[model samples]
Target: MNDESWALSPNTRKPLPQLIEDKIRQLIDSGHFKAGDRLPTEPELAQKMAVARSSLRTALQRLQLQGIVEVMRGRGWYVRSTSVSDRDESLVIDSRISDSDLMEVRIALEATAASLAALRADDGELDEIAKRAREHQGASTEDKEELLQTDEEFHAAVVKASHNELLEQLYRSLVPKLRGYRRNSYGSAELHNRSANDHNQVAWFLKRRDEGGARTAMTTHLLGLYNDLATQAGTAAGERAELNTFAWEDEPRWRDR
Candidate 1:
């Protein structure tokens, strides 16, 4: 594999570590490397990716935390699996685990992530989250694939900013299940843009280090998904009433245009 192929775009707004992370993930996804394949040493990888070792290490730590790759003592990093999560893809498809089930888990994990990120994220991390939110907000609604990818990146950046590896990993594990449902639901630009606005709200709070505000914003954002699922399943009225009993005192704007 050509190391120069991993060169990052100068125009990209993503942080250096994130850019490195994306490049490595892309290489793995494209089959340049596979599970159990050994990756180059730290120095080699940094040189190849044209990034500082600190940035490369940070990227690798995120990947390793998510179970994408494994590090061996006295040896080197190795690709663990190409799949985003180790969770069985069939579990999400078999209907044994409903999208609502995953949604509840996501709400809990992500709200906490946003709150912690607010307390801990550096300026660079905050900037990345804001950049992703804007990208998603302006994403073309007609292009389902592009919209989904942008949305994914925004959420991922938020979770990563939490600086809690375990929390980030747990959230990443839910991505595979969430993607299919989200793709089906993005039927209009309005919906996509609204979600993007929610992302911005979360980022805004994080930038100001307002933990409670960030948490509320994230919960509000996710409740949008809950609303859609409940409506589709004919449980909107009952389920939404039940959801409001949580810590978020404000009525959810699930139906707000």
Candidate 2:
């Protein structure tokens, strides 16, 4: 390994362990290390990065959570292939869904959930939903992933509150896809705030026991997301076509456009 290239320079802003993890990911992506390649010994890597052994281990553990690397007993850390196929089964299924299609199904299911929740949700269920919404609203910029998780929890709470077992099962099955969408679109603080506001509106209607209002609120929120994603997809398609006219030729000719 090239110690000079891999070495981490002094930085005060971000945590040292996170920086180390980022550098390791960069190395893997840049082909400095390939799948199944064993990482350098902990002490060696720590010396190279000018960090403590404990810090290096901490970074490695973070990478392990991300599926970027794996630790072998009595051995060492090895690079894991960061391929789409390596993702969770549900996430792999999510990858196959178009944004528009997923949004359509989500809108249908969640609007119904909101309507039912307004009528069926008890005080306790409403309180749980409110708590989740509050947590999401209070989340900071550094808590983007946490916010996404909270967003799902809030939605799930609403679905559960509907008291429809089949509806809840269907919504649970779509969790992975919903998570993928939120993670992609909720990267910006502005988007996060917008989503929180939408959730608040839905919760408000449900709290008032206004089923029609709750359904409308949920529908409007999902429709807004669908429009945004559709526009983004159209723009990306146009840009890719303009940049490379032959880009489509690389794919299976039999595949649908």
Candidate 3:
């Protein structure tokens, strides 16, 4: 593999860690690092890329979150899989449930949580929610894992503030199932910024103890996310169709049987 082909060049507009991470992805795409291949040691990779060790580690962590790489305890980081479909399959629990189905349940629970939270949350709970929202907004784009974590924390706070044990328990169980979809939905900077703004609006309504306003804001945000996910899925399907048309000219093996 030619190191020059995957060289990391610092961009003024993007974080250094992000640049490094992008280069790593390019390496994977170019066959420099195949699935199950062990990544170079931290110091070696950092020196090779002419970047700080910390920056390289941060980049690796981002890839890990995306399921591109996996760190084996006391062993080292290795490429998990190059294909997004492979990674998605591993993250998803049930093949029967679609993204739309997940979103339907999430919207109902989140809206109810927001409404109840507005009615029940005290000043302290509102303060905690605000703090999480601020953290999410301040997070850098390269730190998407942290951003997602804070976003979950903010929602969890809202659920907790609702003071409904059954609702809280149900939401908690659904969270793990939604992790992959949530990450995909919030992948871009634009989406993240929009979500943060939506969260602020919900927080504002909660602080004012306006149950209706909070519920409406939450509902709108979740619905927007669902639409975005649907659009993305459609686009991806189109791309796959184009690729298959060109690459699979002959009928599939099973089709002839």
Root mean square deviation (Cα) for candidate 3: 15.2
For this target, which candidate reaches the highest TM-score against the unseen true structure?
1
TM-score, candidate number 2? 0.55
Worst 10 residues of 2 by lDDT: 238-247
Q: Local distance difference test, per candidate?
A: 0.77, 0.72, 0.74
lDDT of 1 by residue, 1-257 (tens): 55468777675787677788888888999999999999989999888877778567657765765678766756899998887556223234444777777887788898889988998888988987898888888877786756766777778778878889778767876776676688789997678778988988998889899988898889888887877886786754644433552545652323212
Q: Which of the predicted structures, 2 or 3, would earn the higher lDDT when compared with the native?
A: 3
What's each prediction's TM-score? 0.64, 0.55, 0.55
lDDT of 2 by residue, 137-244 (tens): 877657555665567667877887899867765665566556556667767778888888988988898899998778878877776776687777784533321111
**Candidate 1: segments with Cα more than 4 A from true spot:** 1-95, 236-241, 245-257
lDDT of 3 by residue, 62-157 (tens): 566555786675688899889856553344447577676677677788889999999999898899889878988887777665776677768877
Residue pairs with clashing backbones, model 1: none
Clashes of 3: 0
Deviation of model 2 at 155, angstroms: 0.4
